[model samples]
Target chain A: MMFYINQTSCISPQEFILFDDNHILRKATGGKLFALEPNYKNIPSAQLRRMGKAVRFGVGAALPLLQQGNDVNGIIIGTANGGMEDCMKFLKQIIEFDEDSLTPGNFVQGVPNAVASQLGLLSHNLGYNITNVHRGLAFENSIIDALMLLNEHPLNTYLLGAVDEISDFNYKIELLNGNYKQQSNEGTDFYESGSQGSLAGEGASMFFVSNKKDAAIAKLEFVETIHSSDEEEILNWVEGRLGSHLIEMDKIDLLLTGENGDNRVLKYYTAIESIFNNKISIARYKHLCGEYATASAYAVWLICELFKNSKVPLHIMKVGTPPQKIEKVLLYTNYLGEQHSLMLFSKVK
Target chain B: MTAIVVTGLGIISSIGNSAEENRESLIKSRAGISKNNNFYSRYSTLLPFGEIKKSTAQLMEELNANEKGVTRTSLLALHSIQEAIEDSKLTLNQISSSDTALIGASTVGGMCLTDQLFIDATTASKGSEYLSSYDCASVMLYLQNRYKMKGIVNTINTACSSSSNAIMCGARLIKSGLVKRAIVGGSDSLSKFSINGFNALHILSSDICRPFDANRSGLNLGEGAAFLILEKEEDCKGKKVYAKLSGYANTNDSFHPSSLSEDGQGPFLAMTQAIESASLDASSISFINAHGTATENNDEVESVAMRRIFEKVPAFASTKSYTGHTLGAAGAIESIFSVFNIINQEVYSSLNYTSPIEKTGLVPNLNYRKTSVQHVMSNSFGFGGNCSSLIFSKH
Candidate 1:
């Protein structure tokens, strides 16, 4: 089933760019790559003050897309750690106050569905609002739901996206688990540092999707996710998915990967890389966005940019000759070598 | 188009450990709200909750789930999912197949260990085993890894209506030919995190809840899990088919984050759309499982919505009066109860109801009795004005 990406917006670590403008990729110098949030002058101050970073980026990125019209049938959001700042603050307040006389402000905003709910409230698009919190597959699952809903109702437009914020408390907790590298290094340098952990990252990306091909920049062709550590199993699944679409591996113009400089999981990317065999341009994005559960959302935004520009950005290209004309792009991302996701996108012709 | 049918049901709530036990409790008009004995909380003594009687360790041992980093939420989910899959007679091969989907929902996934997470973040230099399980997706991820589920595995967290949306999503998936079968439900364990959160909101009732009562106080937060196996009607040949998932619709009030509109527009749209989707008239609905949290806002608004939808509202009751408000798990647990209403051709009474609200003069069924239940509508409205309605009809 094909779904059109009618409009796209993102707030990531990289500098915000327009569809026709030249892109500039930013690099994280430390273990954390925080979002370069735009000024919320467009949003009402009272509402903006209550939103956490995730909800801000989410509603900020989504509100503009809904401005075209308020006919959105649903608002779907995905996040692994939603509204973390408020969640932690509420948890801390419970302890400090000994669970007495605490306010509901933070608690209400801390729930994982806060983004979708907030968007629904702001846009007044009281449709099928939902949130997906599945680890690495969060954004992909949102896409799947949007696709199914559109397929069920072709005329319906949906606002789908993902958001995750990096908090001081969460960062420290994750550091204990070695989810981030110990050393401070440039994003690109860390990719080749042969390290054990990837840099932490946070961002929000939203897409307006519908079944209509007109006015669409790109068409999402396929999306699939799996939980496996075996490289061969993932390889076979990718091939099977492509074969179902009747597309040859050589036909893919760009192989976008979520290689976030984790040495242990580099082999999985390498295994997938061998299938292309230098036939197509391969690029990486986590260097710009860092590595988070919904980093794939940023990848989708990048794919939209590449399709809009019809060229691969120099900073993201890692291997293979740049394609003369970018047509079909394949995105393969893995979260710690366990959660594997494959998404295929093509220029809407 | 293929019709979706519920072939198997599994549930673990305060009233019982299995489906049979729950059925017996409902038949005997048993209410499960009580003081917490297994879960520890500051208000555990002051407030009543629909807490499962067993401890986490006992649940783990009973389910043989000794996996590291497993939380109580995951354990409850595993207990119910085991029963669901077994009741459906689905083999490991079928479960591991790519055609099967598991869509779980939870608002309190692994946040049940908020205390541990707090200690690890604030005091301990090193995180505990519960560190990785602190997110809302942990429960579904744990279940997926345990079952080695190869198909679409996703988790939805839309507050209290989470599992209703899960069930709706599963039905849509099966109807869309995306998957052959789906295991859909939600699980939430009572914890200090949620208790404090609810208390902070000033919605937690000290006494057992009284849904639709004239002078209802508030809701008692509960803990439980429920899963239902849904497949195409054609697929369940000789299985113990419970009911057909005739229709479902999800809508938002777009009104407030924590409160619905006074008119209950979201619930009205949800109920109307769900009935329309089933291609049935509002008059056909035999019983309704209302969202009624016994709050001043919810019960009144739900009654107004019911009045708007039906000329004379059918026999309806709030199972939350029996189970307390189970939050994320209430949708599916009540959905299973709705199945019992169909399979047994009966309607369970709403407990502790005295008088109707003056605004709507709506009185819920106060007694359990056998009836010709053909279609049942289950309502779940959650935070963010997320309202959903599901209809189950006799197969």
Candidate 2:
């Protein structure tokens, strides 16, 4: 079954709130990059104060895409470290107070599915709801869930998205584990540094997906996720997918790679580039959004914007000549050479 | 349509370490709830829990996993996952193949190391090995890396119903021709985070939990892991097919974050829809493994839902008396109990029940007995009003 994106809302470090205007595209550096805050005038003050970054962004991004009268039969969300700020606070409380008289607010709101559940409660969506917490592949897993929901119930509209946040505690852990670069550097020129780590970033992206093609920004042709580090395994996966879909390599108009200046994980993207003989136009998106577990979701939102505008971002370094017609865009991303995901998006013509 | 069958079952909870042992405990009406002495917890003296006897070091030694960063959650999951793979007779090649999907559910994951996380956050040390093992997906990632699994691996966290959704998602994936087989289940070890959280909610029972009873206090927080190997009937022709996973439905109550609606609409819809999907009548089910958390709201609402669905409310029992509330693993653990009912043609008794709630006037099966069992419906409801029901029929 084919899935179409009816509406999308994104909150990233970039200035654009949704898919409207993109006048100020800020440069994401190697240090921590937080998403641009959105207005929360729609939510009650008490409820907004209780929510953490993930929930605030998640609800803020989702409310705009949901139509007033339309029924949402499903809600699926993805997050790597959900409500990290609250979780850390609870952990510290547990230790500081000698595990006595702990606060309930942090503990209650720290769960990974809090965002999805909050949305359900806010909108009174009494349908199938779930959350995936896999790193790197979380958003892809959400897409998979949405696809299955559409296939099982063709008439249902689903809300699918991902949210992740970077707190001081989480950032320190990432820095210690050699996941983020300590030195500041321009993200657009990430590969030029040949740095050991990528920039730390956080964001939330939500999409209103439906089987009906009305009011859609793009058509989700296919989405696949594979956990493999071996080059041959990944190549075999690509080959099998192409053969099963009956699509030639040349039919792929553009290749979106997640190259975020981390040389250790950049080889996987390079291998794919070589397999296609560097023929297809390759585009990079980590510069604009930095890197996170669900950064690929941001990349997907970026693709939707690209399709709507019919032009690539000026900061995205082009590898080859642009295709005559950008009909098929295949996104390939791998994090720390562990979880590899691919998503194929086609223009809604 | 290809029928999805459960060919293998694995479980390790406070009562027993394997399916047969747990079944024995069930038949003998054994309860594993006690003071939380086995694990380090300030609530050890104040609250009761279903904590496994084995320590993390013991688990590591038995599993031969001396890795520095491995957490108790991962170890528990690996123990059951290995048992499941062995019970299914799947070789290394099959498990590591691209067609075998692994879907794990966990509410706490490595966050069970709450103390260590607190230390890491407070101190200025460069890092501890436990840094990466802090989210709900860490255990799944550990398994993926350890087993060299190449299939689609995902993690689900919807509070208590996490594993039930995992099982449903796994079956759907196979039905959609995405994979040939699935290793689906969840694991959760006792931790201070959940204990304190549940304590704050005033839901953690100080005494042993009593489900559907008039004096039902609160729920005793528990922890363990259970996994089921699901494959198509055609592929498992000669294998021992325990039961067929026939129907499943997930619904949200949208009433409260921590409580269900008064009418139990989520539970009602999930059960009725599952029965419909199974192509069976409400009377066809032989038994039901109820999501009896022993909390004040859950048992009452669940009983009301049962009354709405079945006129007689078939021979139903809550195995939480034996396993406590295993959180993410509750669904899979109760599911295994339901399968045991189908295979052995017996009904396990519910313990610590003196009187039924005045509202529902429903009483569960109070004694274990050998009987003709054909189909069983398992209910798993979670926080945030996430409710799921699965129907398993005799294969």
Candidate 3:
């Protein structure tokens, strides 16, 4: 099943606009890459004050698209850790005050579904609303659901997105867990650094998906998540998907890999690269967006840009030359060698 | 399109540990809400909770779940899912097949270790073993790894309606031909995090909860897990067919973050749309398992919505009075109770009910009796106005 990406928006550590030659590459500082949030002047001041980082970035990225006079039939969001700051605050208060005299503000905002719910309330979309909280496959699951729903409705458009924010407490814990790199590296050099850990990052990316192709920028060909650590099994699964879709290796113009500079897991990507046989131009994105569960959302956003601009950004291209006329792109990402996901996108003809 | 049918059912709640035991408890009019004995919280003594009579250590020992970073939430889920798979007679090959999907839901997955997490984050330079199991996805991840499930695995967290949406999503997956079978349900264990959170909200009842009663107080928190195996009707050759998933609909109220609208717009739309999707008239519904959290706002709003949807409201009762509002697991547990209503051809009484609310003057069924139940509707509403209604019918 294929659905069209009619409109899209993203808020990441890089600039919000499309990349240009003069665009400065933003690098991680102190092993953490935070989202470059837009000024949420469009949202009400009172409401803005009550929103958390994830909610703000999610809603801020989606509100402009929704304001363009499109009636969305559903709102689906994916997040790994939702409203961690608020949750941590509530937990601290409970421990401090002994669970007494505590308010309900943080408790309500800390739920995993808060971003989707806030989108629903703000957009007045009473239709199907849900949130997916799977680890690295969170955003991919959301897209799968949206496509299935589009298949069911046929005429309805859906607002689909993924958002995650880094909280100070969670960052500290993850750092201790050895999930992030101990030393900071330049964004462009992080992938080749062969470090033990990846930089911690956060972002939000939203899209308007529908079955109709009118005004579409790109078409989603396939999406799947594999739960295997065996390199041979993962390779076989990817081959099976390509064979099922009848997509030849030569038809794919670019291969986007989610290499987060974690040396231990770089072998998985090396195995995937063998399948393409070095024929396809390969690019990497975790350097710019950092490594989080749903960083695939940013990858999709970059694919949209590649198709819209008909050029691959030089900063992201790692191997081979940039495709002169981009048509099809395949994305493969594995998180900590446990969760593997593959997505294919094509330019609308 | 082939109909989706439930082939197996498993439940562990305050009432019982299995489906048969739960039914027996309900028939005997035994309410499970009482003072907490296993969970240690500041409100444990002052308030009543429908806590299962087993500690985390006991559950771990019984389930043989000695894996690192395993919390009570995952243990409860493992207990029920094991029963469900065994009851369905699914072979190991079928269990590991890519055609079977697992959709789990939870509001408090590993947050049950909030105290441990706080202590570790505050003092320990190196994170503890519990660090890997601290997010909402840990429960499902643990289950997926344990079962070796290779198909689509996803977790939904729409608060109270989490598992109902899980069931609904599983049904959709089957209907879309994405998978042939889906093991769907949810589990939530008692935690100081949730107890204190609900206390902060001022919705925890000190005494036993009395849903639909005029002077009903708030709800009592509970913990448990329930899972139902759903397969296409054509696929279940000789299995025990419990109920057919006929209809389901999810709608947001777009109102307040915590409260429903005065008119219950979300509930009304969800119920009506579910009925329409089932291609049945409103009068065809024989019983309704209401969301009825026994709160000042939920019971009244749900009542208003039921009245608006059904001309002569059918026999309806809130099972939360029995299970004490098991947040994420409430939908699946209540849904299994609804299936029992169809399978046994009987209705269970709503305990601790005296009078109906003055506004709607609605009265729930008060006695256990045999009846002809054809179709049953189950409602679950959660925070952010996430309301969902599911309809099940006799197979």
Candidate 4:
């Protein structure tokens, strides 16, 4: 089934507004990197006060994609560590107060679906709302859900998105777990230089998808996920997805890898790079967005940008000359040496 | 489109450990709510809960899941998922195949081990071993690793309607030819975190929850796990098909974070949409497993919604009285009950239900009855104004 991306919105470290040519790609001296703050002057301050950073980013990213109270048939979200600040606050309250007189606000905000449901509650769209919280594959799950929904109904406008946040506690926990580096380093050359850990980053992206091709930003042709270490398995998965769509390996003009300057996890991307024979134009996003579970959501947003501009930002794109006519872009990201996800987007000409 | 068939069933709840045991409790009108004993909390002496009798250690020992960072949520999930895979007669190869998908849901997850999480996140004494168990997807990832499931594994958390959404997502994946079969359900073990969280909401009933009761005060928090093995009709040709997942719908109240609208628009739309999806009229519904949370807000709103949908409301009951609100697991746990209604051709009573709400004047099925039940509609509403309904028809 063909699904068109009607609109896209994202809140990341880099300015997401159109015509913003600023390239801010540097590893954080601080441990955590926050998404660029979006103006929320329109939302009620009372309701806004109760939300956390993640909720604000999610609602901020989603509210703009809707067509002023349009009947959105589904609201699907993907998040790795949703509302971590609220979750940690609630957890802290439970521990400090010894389970006595705890506020309900933190607990309410801690839910993974809080962002999606909050969007639905705000827009008054009583359609299907679900939140996928599968570590690295969270946003990919949302894509699959959007595809399945469109395949089943073929005429429904759906809101699909992802969100994640980093709390001080979340950052500390990751640091203790050795998932991120404590050392500060410039990330512009993230592919060549970095410590043992990748910089922790958080962001949110929302897409309005439907069967209608009118006013679409891009067309999503294929998406798949696999948990495998076998090179042949990965190759076969990609080949099968492209083959079923009657596309070939050489037709894939660009490949987006989820390499985040972490040498340990770079092998997965290297394997994919080998499959494309180093011929396809390849780019990287983690240098700009840093490393997080749903960082691929940011990669997808970047893909939409490449489709619109046909220009790859030099600060993040790595290896291979840019294709003269960017037609098809493939995204490959793996989290924690497991959960490998691949997505293919094509310009809807 | 291939019909989604329920070929296997598993359950571990406060009242029972297996599907058959739960079925028996349903028929016998056994209520599981009691003073919290297995788990200790500040509200242990004050509120009743549907706490399973087994201790966490005992569960881990029995399941042979003695590993670092293994939480009670994973243990409960393992028990139910193992039962489901076995009941489906699936081999190890099939369990590990890329054609099989596992969709699990849970809200508490490892947060059930609140003390360990607290210590791990705080003071940081060698970072407690349970640090990795706190996310909503921990239990699901643990199960996926256990079975080596590779096909579209996902975790969903929409509060009370989580597992129902998981089940719906699984079926949609199958219908879209993404997977051949899916093991779908949710698990949540009772913990001080949820108990205190609900207590803070001022919705924890001190007595056993009286769902649909006119004087119903609040809900009693509970936890457990339940799973269903759903396969395409072609794959389950000769299998024991319990029921067909005919239709499902989810709608948002868009009204509040924790409360439904006074008109019950969310529940009403969910019920009507689900029936319409099944290509069946509202009157075709034989029974309804209402989302009667027994809270002052939920019961009345659900009744109003039911009145708006079913001209003559079908024989409906809130099994939440049997298994206190299981949060993320409530959807799947009650879905299993709905399937059992189709399989056994019986309608179980809503335990402790007294007079109906004065506004709608709707009384649930107060007694168990053996009848010809063709379709059973189950409802699950969550804190985010997420309301979902699923229709299961006899195969």
Model 4: CA > 4 A from native: A17-27, A67-71, A229-236, A239-246
Can you list the residue pairs that collide in candidate 1? none
lDDT of candidate 4 over A283-306, digit per residue (tens): 777766778889998888888888
Q: State the TM-score of candidate 3 restricted to chain B.
A: 0.99
Model 2 error, position B56 (Å): 1.0
Expressed as tens digits, the lDDT of each residue in B1-395 for candidate 1 is: 79899988999999999999999999899988989887567898999999899999999899888988999999999999999999999999899889999999998988888788888777856778887888878898898889888999989989999999999999998888889999999999998999999899888888889999998999998899999999999998877888999999999989999998999999999999999999999999999999999999999999999999999999999999878888889999999999999999999999999999999999899888999999999999999899999999999
Q: How well is each residue in A129-175 modelled by candidate 1, as lDDT tens digits? A: 88999888989989999989998898998998999999888888777
Worst 10 residues of 3 chain A by lDDT: A16-25
Instruction: Give the residue spans of candidate 3 off by over 4 A.
Output: none
Better of 2 and 3 by lDDT: 3
Poorest 10 consecutive residues by lDDT, candidate 2 chain A: A16-25
Q: B289-330, model 2: which lDDT tens digit per residue?
A: 999999999999999999998988898898898889999999
Candidate 4 chain B lowest-lDDT run of ten: B117-126
**Interface residue Cα RMSD of candidate 4 after superposition:** 1.2
> Second chain TM-score per prediction?
0.99, 0.99, 0.99, 0.99
Each model's DockQ score: 0.83, 0.74, 0.80, 0.73
**Model with the higher TM-score, candidate 1 or 4:** 1
Error of 4 at B172 (Å): 0.9
Model 2, stretches more than 4 Å misplaced?
A17-24, A321-324
Cα deviation at A41, candidate 4, in Å, is 2.3
TM-score of each: 0.98, 0.97, 0.99, 0.97
Which docking category, incorrect, acceptable, medium or high, applies to candidate 3? high
For model 2, what is the alpha-carbon lDDT of residue A338?
A: 81
Which rank order by DockQ, best down to worst?
1, 3, 2, 4
